[model samples]
Structures are given as C-alpha cells and as structure tokens.
Target: MTNHTVRPRSAGALAAVLAATALVTLGAAAPASASGPACPTDTIIDGSRLASISPECSFAGDQVNVGGVVMSIPNPGASVRASSAVAAGYQDVPDVVVYRAGNGGVAAVAGDQEFGSEGTLAALRSENSAVAASARPSAVSTLDSAPVVPGCDDRTAYKLSGEKWAGAYEWSYNNTGSPVTSGVARIQDALDTVTGGVTRCGSDVDLTATHRYLGTSTNSVDVTKAGGCSEGDDRSTIGWGELSSKYLATTCSWSQDGIIVSSDIKFNNRAPWWDNTGRACQGKTYDLQGTATHEAGHVFGLDHVAPATHQVMKPASDPCEYSQEKLGAGDAEGLKRLYG
Candidate 1:
C-alpha cells in the first residue's frame, strides 16, 4: 500500500488577529491518516520525491475526501464560505486530497468519490467511471493555501482522470491537532454561545480572489507592501495593519470535476502558529495546520467568520481578536445549506 500526507508551512508576515493556537475542536487524536490510494505507512516527499506518487486531487487538489472517505468541494458557484455559519456562502466545504510516495511504481487504483444529492451524485459518479482510466492530475498546487486562478472552470461533474506525477499530498496535522474534529458541530456551538443561534446566512454573493495562484503560487497579492512591515502607510490599503514584504501569496484554482477548489491560507504575524512577521512566505516551509483549516473554508467558497466574534472564519483586527479555534454553529448550517 502507498502512504501519503499533507504539507506544512510556517507563519505569515502580517497578523490577521484571531487568537487561538491550535484551531481544532472536533475529531479524535491520532496521527495524520490517509484515506485514499491505500496507505500502509505515512508518505513523505522532499524536493526529490514529488515525481513518484503522481498525486492529484479531484481538480488540482481542490477536491479532497473527508475523513479520507467522503469527497467535497465538487462544483463552482456552490457557495463556499469562510469560518462563520451566519455568513451566506459558508456552506461550501473544500475537498481533502490524500497522497503517498511512488518510487517508479504504478499509481494505485482509487474508488469513486461521490457528491451532490444521492441520485444526482450517483449518476455523475457512473458517468465519470466510464472515463476514469484516462484522467491525469492537472498542474494544481497541493499546498494548504493555493493561488486563485481566474476564469477557471469547475470540475466537469462527471469525469475520471489520471496523472503522471508521483507523490502523496501529506496532511500537515490531523483532527487530533484541532480543537474540533466535527467541523460542522463545532461551528454551530459557537453561534449558540455568542448570538444564541439567531443569526442566519446573510448574502449569496460571489467572492473572487483578486490574486492568482490560489493554492500553490507565492506571488499575486493585493494587500501589504514590499518591506513586510505591518505599520506602513501604504500597508493600509486594505487596512491600517502591519505588512510583511516577504510573504508568498496563494493561488486559487478550479477542479475539472466542477466541485473542488483551491486558495491560499493567510495568517497574522502575531499568532502563535506564525512565528515570523518580517520574512518571506514560502509554500514549502510554513506549516500552520489551524491557519490552513481556516483558509480551506475560504478556498472551498466560504467567507470570513461571521458575527465577527464567533466562528473560525471571521477576520481578525488584532492579534487577540482572532479566536476561532473551532467551527461554530453558523459554519455547519452554512455547509449543510450549500450542499444538502
């Protein structure tokens, strides 16, 4: 069996202001586990092993399996939200991809990943199976925070694929590292604790990444300056916040299956997971698991946490304001509404 895992990164240059070291709240504690391609051991990738596993997500790692079993983020305009359930688009969840090392071995066979309503998703699966033999992995980034690709098409809804690249996409950490494993429930609890569960989805608006390379690229950012200071006048374009000149921007891309998506994870310099505030952002070096989970919500089509108080998706104004260690009630509702 092949073993694969997700990647990791250090902290970011500027501080977004949410306060919570390990932003996990559900699931049990266990080492990161693989749910795809059959893994007997953990897969490792260095500068040299990327060529062996030929790892691929539904569409450029945009689509991933939940708990290594269920597939998610399978369509465009499907309403991916950030950390808050009160927010309208928070319903969409990004898919999780699994990877493992491949050293001149044939790629392992994979089972069909189904989504949508039972019947709808089933038919789509059958259609995809007919063509699964020829599918290949797209040039999509597998990092937690990827770049945003404009004018990209969602996964085709029914298509099977393959790839020549070989390697596993490792999970930086598992739910055990998180405060909440059941992301949906954790989010709901947050809402009740704060707003008494009265808030509802606000808008069905469309959010586009002004920058490109949603998950893989290091360049393409709209905010921050070249000096990497959070306290410059120009750094206030987005707001009056510190900026980091060396942070790498993420790319956002679409999946061919028309479901999964990708984007970059942004972190504040003051946060615990982020140790540096004035250095460059390298997709290869930084590995903040919690921060990545927060960004994953956005990449899947969710927006920032709502109520600005509860929910992991909310934007932080200060290092202390960021407090979404888990998904709140609002987060769960948003997802069910989007997919269910």
Candidate 2:
C-alpha cells in the first residue's frame, strides 16, 4: 500500500493543525482494540489466529483505508471533493482515497500497515474509507464584514448539476494557525456574498436560499490541511492547512437520502492568496475571498460546472482573480433549483 499520509510536524504544530477541523475523524494514535479490527470473530474462523473480525472494521490507527487503493482527483482542477451516501453496506458507499500530503498536516502513511496478515489486506481495504469534516479558526485575524467579492460580473453561460443544502444550514471557519493573506472576517464576507442576488451579468436574478454563519470554531476539519478527508463528523468547517502540491483547496461532503448533512473546506496553506483587501498576490496568487466564496457554494451543495460556463461553481478559479467572489446567474439558478 502506498503511504500517502502527510508527514508529522512538531507536536505543538500538529496539535494546532488538528484543532482546526471536525469532519468526522478519529483521534490519532488510539490504542488498538483488545480483540483487534472490528470484524466478526467467526467470519471465516478465528481459529486462523487473526483474532476478532467483523465487517466495517475501524482500525485504531489512520481512519482512512491504506491498502493499495489509490483514488485520483479529476483533471484541470487542484482540489477534490469526496462524497458518499450513507448505507448499511460499506460497498454501497464510495470512499475517496486521500492523496499524500506534507508536513504540518495529518500523519501520512509511507508503507504497508500490517494488521494480522498480508492475506487480510483486501478485507482491510474497505476499512477507514471515510473522511473527516472537523474545524476551528487558526491565523486569520480579521473578519471583513463587508462584501469582498463582487457579484454579477461574469457573462459566461452555464448549467446546473443539481445538489444543494436543504432549508438553511450553518458553517464555521478555522484559521491557518499562522495568519494567511486574508483574515477570518474577509472569509466570512466572501461566504455571505454567495447567497444573494446576481445583479450584473445581463441576467439579474435573486437567489433566496440562505445559510447562517456560526462564527469560528476549533473543530477538527474533515479534510486535514495535509490533503485528505476524515470520515463521519457532521459539522461544516472551514480552515487552512497543507494540501497536495496540486490542490489550491478541497472540500469533503457527506449526505444521506440525497440531502447534504456535513461538509468541510480546507484551503491549501502552500498556495498564494489575496484577501482582495490589504494584501495582494505577487505575480499570480489566488483570490482568497474568491476561492472561499466558491468553496461555500460547494458547501451549499453546488457542483462544479466547467469554467467556460462562468458559474461560481466551476472547478478552477483564476490566479489573482476576483470574479468567483460572486455568483453568476447559472450559479444562483442551480441553488434556486435546490433550495428554491
């Protein structure tokens, strides 16, 4: 199995990183269960000395399965959003294998983790197939109450893939431990900017669906800053952390019966960001507020449309671009279908 786990950092730094997310993850380094992996002891016979056994085993270490399974992110986009439907059978759910990350993030697996025997690797492949959605504010010091990203600027045509928040859900922010270019305030403003009307793209329209900001929290995030999602926490958190070199940001979501219940957002700590406020990107930096605005659209259940369509939910944001800070008519219309 490929060890894609993020390398560990200093104890203090790792704690700070772990404190920022709450997307259904297990505490690191939990002691092994007395009987071992939660499989039925009688499965094929405990007489084989494999100890206890059961379906859906929750390993003490690394909550994500570390078998040879490698899930790849889609192309042309830096971030990936992993989602699954809750079901009785694990096979019924699709688990997104997290790519390996770097230091200052979660533990990255580097080799095969032996549990019982190599023969059992296939069975363990399905274990820990979940993502964390936890969070807390880290280094963002200011909260820009004013709208940072403008709305109604895009003129591109787009269509909706159709998923959304039911009624009104709430979300929180977690900082990067060390302040990034943007502060918590500006991030909030960017998020709020997504819900209203799109007023300038030749087709002015109103999107009435709404969500409340719950302020900042220390909840561990679903996707660690190191580039993977912890499974099963039901909170929607936003925070900063190290991601794979390819990603600028990532979001993890889970739902049941076709309704979204949990979602978390993690901005890549390694990426250059502009708050669209005091600090600006050097040669080419991502507009923090704009990226945030787009991620919020995903938290609200918007799927990515191609960038050519010009919707805020497109997979990629332009470098130093601010257009994504607001919703396009297509973006709003999609939300309208979900919550309207």
Most accurate candidate by TM-score: 2
| Candidate 2, lDDT over the whole model | 0.47
Residues 1-340 of candidate 2: C-alpha lDDT, one tens digit per residue? 1233432223432443344334212323212233332222111111122222332232222333324222222111111235321111112122242221111111112222333333233222222221111111121111112223243333223332223455666777787453464567666776667666432344334455576778879877767433445553678877877765556667676544234566787777776667756654656676777777776776665555654565666666667666776666556655554444
Q: lDDT for model 1, on a 0 to 1 scale?
A: 0.26
Among all candidates shown, the one with the greatest lDDT: 2
> Would you estimate the TM-scores of all the predictions?
0.25, 0.55
Which residue runs does candidate 2 get wrong by more than 4 Å? 1-162, 202-204, 225-227
Q: Write the per-residue lDDT of candidate 1 for residues 1-340, one digit (tens) a residue.
A: 1222332211120011122225322221112223232111112212122222222212222222222222222232221111211112223222222222122111111233322233333433443343343333332222112112211111111111211111111111112222222432332232222222121222121112122111222232222222111111111011011223222111122223333332222233322332233353343332233234344444333444323334444433222222333333344333322322
Q: What is the C-alpha RMSD, rounded to one decimal, of candidate 2?
A: 15.4
Alpha carbon deviation, residue 51, candidate 2 (Å): 25
lDDT of 2 at 214: 89
TM-score of 2: 0.55
